[model samples]
Target: MNIHSVAPKRPDLDRLLIDSALALFAERTYEGTQMPAVAQHAGVGVGSIYRYFPSKEALGNAAFRYAKRTLLDTLAEALADGGPAGTAREEFARFWRGFTRYASAHPDAFVFLEHQQHDTFLDPESRALADELHRVAADFIERGQHAGAIRDGDAEQLVGLALGAFTGLVKLARPAGGLDALPAEDLDRAEAAVWDLLHRKADR
Candidate 1:
């Protein structure tokens, strides 16, 4: 069998290149990253990358899609577990836990995804996937507004605030070791603080 022909969305070699590329993208950035460097990082030859990714932009989009898809999957799984009866607060907690889970599992990917700008080199599919996740987040906020659990505001702005605060919290933990190294008490308090930013004043 020609493994490459019938392989999954990304074959093993393809995944390796994508991972190496993402690590570089996180460290050196998209424009700074080179195909040869990616190969060296992955312990492969420069030609191997070309066989899988036609160019740096193609490799970048692959990495972005992989990272974004992983995040979307993590969040989706978290919310799916919550089911139809889950309260807005419960759903919100799921999102927090989901994000932390993604960051913990794929620190490089998390950094790669968050640090890059969408308009830079993301292909249509990559941007569409990001937009899909954003819509999911906005839906959560709109639902919370109806439930009177979230504070009134533009859902996009609220999503931005929630994500910005969450991102800052994670960044604060990186230098120390990772989110796991942070005290449970501190992580708990950070989650609560973010919730406070989104919660309705009347929620009490």
Candidate 2:
């Protein structure tokens, strides 16, 4: 039998590699991380990494895309629950809580994504996904504006402001230890601040 033909695809191994890569990348950064380190972290041979990903760059992009998709999927689910129709503040609050929960629970994935946002290793597909995420966020902001709950302004600009605030809060909440170590009250304050920034003056 041809060895190549008989080689089994190990999705478990692939997941392990990606998870390990995310943790290492978050701790050491993309350029500072190596395939050997990832393999060692995953308790696999260095050559095994190439079976799932051709190169370090490929692994980085794959990890980023995976994390981004996971985050987006979580947000989608948070928005899917039947809530008060057209109640933008309630919907936004639910989504924000879900986002922070995910970010805190999966700090490695969140950190990896945050650090790789501008990485050149990201392929066209990854770049497109990033754009899609932004579009989704802008749409959410536009919905609030349409409902007269958000301040009147450019949707994208509003998104940028909200995103900046959330990102800063995430960073501040994240101590040298991790996001899970952040105080619950501090996280609550961060969410309130973001909500206040997005709320219309008339609604306040």
Candidate 3:
């Protein structure tokens, strides 16, 4: 058996190959990247990549899943440090801003994640993971509603709205200046705008 073919069976090789695939996908769009390039970048044989991920799409899915996990972990840390979920609008804004900054700085990673939802190449497991992430977001929205922080609405619908706003803000901030390109005053204003949308005064 070839060393490359055998390597994929090793746990470490799986991570190594996936990391390389993601890096290439980040730099190049899905259609533009090839398995060979990923293999080369990973310092493994092309066959090795195949052993773990049958196709480029599968590889892309794995990369995207990794990125999502990483982003959520970072968000969790920011939220933990900022304050509890009840009344930390400023902290939440700060976390959102930081998350946006991270995404802008890692456009390749972000684009890979955005594309994952539409990619037909993703395996069943990867698709399941993506669906679970969305469900978790919906659950969080429901929790907020229960806490009297959010307006009464379908949690799933509200999640979609919140994500739309989040992504839209990132896009708006991208060209004029990356997330951090905005001055302190501008960021402050943006932060206030976000909190205002999420936390309006309760209707009598």
Candidate 3's C-alpha lDDT? Answer: 0.68
For each candidate in turn, give its C-alpha RMSD to the true structure in angstroms: 3.6, 3.6, 5.4
> Roughly what TM-score does model 3 have, to 2 decimal places?
0.70
Top model number, TM-score: 1
lDDT by residue (144-178, candidate 3, tens digit) is 66767767777777656656666666667667765
Q: What is the lDDT for 168 in model 2?
A: 71
Q: In candidate 2, how many Å is residue 153 off?
A: 2.5
Pairing residues by index, what is the TM-score of model 2? 0.86
- Estimate the lDDT of model 2: 0.82
lDDT, candidates in the order shown: 0.87, 0.82, 0.68
Candidate 1 lDDT score at position 61 = 86
Ranking by TM-score: 1, 2, 3
Among all windows of 10 consecutive residues in model 1, the one with the lowest summed lDDT is 2-11
Superposition TM-score, candidate 1 onto the true structure? 0.91
**How many residue pairs clash in each candidate at the backbone level?**
0, 0, 0
